[model samples]
Target: MLSLLLVALLAGSGAIGVAAANDAEREDKPGGAATSQGPRNRSAFSNPSGNLSFARQLDFKLGDGVFRKLWVAAPSSTRSSDGLGPLFNARACQACHLKDGRGRPPGPEEQPSSLLFALARPDGSPDPVYGKQLQTFAIQGFAAEASVQISHKPRVITLADGLRVTLQQPQYELRELAYGPIDPTTTLSPRIAPPMIGVGLLELIPEADILARADPDDKDGDGIRGRAHMVASPTNNGRQMLGRFGWKANTASIADQSATAFLNDMGLSTPLFRDGFGDCTAAQSACRAAPDGADDDGMEVPQKLFDLTVFYARNLAVPAREGIGAPAVRRGQKLFSDIGCAACHVPRQVTGASEELPELANQVIWPYTDLLLHDMGDELADPGTPGDSRDGRLWRTPPLWGLGLTRRVNDHDFLLHDGRADGVLQAILWHGGEAAKARDRVIALRKVDRDALLAFLESL
Candidate 1:
């Protein structure tokens, strides 16, 4: 029996339907057979997929080594680990994605390691001197691009029940400019490294299934228009494919994402990005002239090593949902649908066939995202880049699996692209544009109902 209020809420928000209250009492494993049954602690996100075969486990371990391997300056005795950076953010993939979980913005006076700045012009061009990303670290002979400082301004919102929740709005500034002043019009978008859970399964989701959910014109008048981000596939010879990864859905594959990070974050050239200087612009001549770590193949990271890192990233398992049978969590699940959050934060998706990794094939999983681009409104928008007209306003809906383990795995619960929101509640509060109607519903909920909603989210 549905409550009249719940039914009206669903109808108004265009939600198809939600499971019965008691249905959640059944054990719900969000990641299908790939879900990790690891202990609920700091190591929760570091486990391999539960269904991975014994032989494949060795490959996962080998990949883990490459992920945590540290790189140093060129001409070092450790030939394989050289080519760190002329200007880079971190020495290793593990440095930014600490403990294989989400990264946090640095506190005042702390130099950013996980949090880095992206520099670009209105036309999506890199800053002439600083290039694409602002690197705060450099090798001995080269100067780091610049240091960054962050400050917070508190903004308080009063809920319908008159409870006040204060959110910290972050302000960023660049200091110690070694490459001279950057272009005045360059947009500085701060990005925090996201978690590495259930990405393999996400990569395996059928493109047709995701495209079927897109309603770009909002012809149904649901006020929720999700559009797919079409990107040129690097492996497919410039063929346009659905962009599945990254904050703006700008990247199409995990392998591509890993290669980009290797170049930009560690200044290590891979087979995909053969630039020895990484993001160093031609304007920085000293960086271009610096010694490189290229091996016989003329790439810092050889193909074999690169493949291992990608495997590690692709196989990080999503942890099983906790506290699902609780009454409050069940109530919250219904409210999540009733309030329209489920419209975009889609609760379930089935991965298509994967010949490469058969364990991930044809499995029902719960990642809680449509993997579509939505206009998130001005509050969350970065500066517009000409490359994509919707660059500023649109963002990919990030998967919500393993979100509840943030504090345990990473010691922080910062959410959103820039890590401004402190917790799930604040993240929801910051939603706008296509999500504004749903955000309003959450704000107007009774305190008990609100608590349940949060409970359901935490259980995911």
Candidate 2:
């Protein structure tokens, strides 16, 4: 009768599809069994995998202490945690990545802390005054590079159903410059800190698998050409390695990324970047002459401490999907693939044998990113010059595994590189180049269908 017809329509529309995805995941993939799942809690995104051994768990605790520990200015009593800044952004990693969650652009009357600015010239050289990053904080007696100011302009997009969503385009202003006026042609990129979950799992994704998914030349003619970023690896004597971290995919591994953050964000040198005077170019004479935190090991962040912090970063677990059993989410999951979003946001990935952490190996995890660079076109591109030497139009595919918990964990709902789009839908509307067709499909969706897709995303 009427009930039977309803069931048939529901089945046709993928009402029961999510069970299949979940059922397949029942293979008991150790790390794949999503680590954090429950009602919202402060520690939701800050748990170690329950599968770790007692000794390994202690190691995670050690790394957590280092990760959250605040660095003091050099010549302090605490020699191990000294060497904060001649010029820097935040004192601790937790300051930027609050609660191991995403960072947003500053709100009204708030100074930028979790966010940092990148300064580069048109010829791919660092600015003479600002160097590479603009640091807004400094130790005693030293002037910070600049003060950051942000304001938003609203760009409203009306959907097919007459629903209007206002997206905020961020305007960055640099004031109280310590050195001099910036070059007229200098390009500025403001980066909001991304979530820290599942970084180790993403790192463990086999290089071969990443390469297999790359279609740099668009040989398949799908208009989705994802290319791996090649960057000089500091760990490998500057040999070329696939860039897997950062907005531009410019960082090779978790170790390199952590070291870069320590040096650039906190002005604390690590074993990789051994200079005690962080990102200070020769022009900044005061910064060059500043005291360092180097102890008996001759490095600010000693090798063992550096490795412990990297381990902490590598093992943070991805939160489990919340509403996978919901019919609306199932439909949206199916629709996500049908609309070609999966071409770039490749959902399922298996980790290879991990030489560093074996607990992260062979898990059928869903990170929802190819970790490849895609051309997002000019709208999202940084004005003037490329952020790195890479194309101005390109950005690395950010993972979507912990996205649903973003607002819950971070208390704000900003998305994208600079936290421009207010939420996920605006982020989708901002997509272009390789993802244009997918964006078009989302724009053209019925209100119910769009709701379903958003439901699916929220379930993630």
Record all residue pairs in model 2 with backbone atoms less than 3 Å apart, i.e. clashing: none
lDDT of 1 at 227: 96
lDDT of 2: 0.81
User: Which RMSD values do the candidates have, in order?
Assistant: 3.6, 5.0
- As a whole number from 0 to 100, the lDDT of residue 1 in candidate 1 is 45
Write candidate 2's Cα lDDT for 189-241 as tens digits.
88889999888888888888898878999998999889988888887888888
List TM-score per model, in order: 0.94, 0.92
Tens-place lDDT digits, model 1, residues 1-460: 4576775454333343543342233226667888886877899999998899889989999999999998999989999999888788999899999899999998776889898777789778889999888899999988989988788899899999999999888888888999899999998888889999999899999999899889999988999899998987765666888899888887789987898899888899998888889999999998999999999999999999999888888889988877787889878877888898888988777789978988788877778889999999988887744245337889889999888889989999999999999999999999999999999999999999999999888877
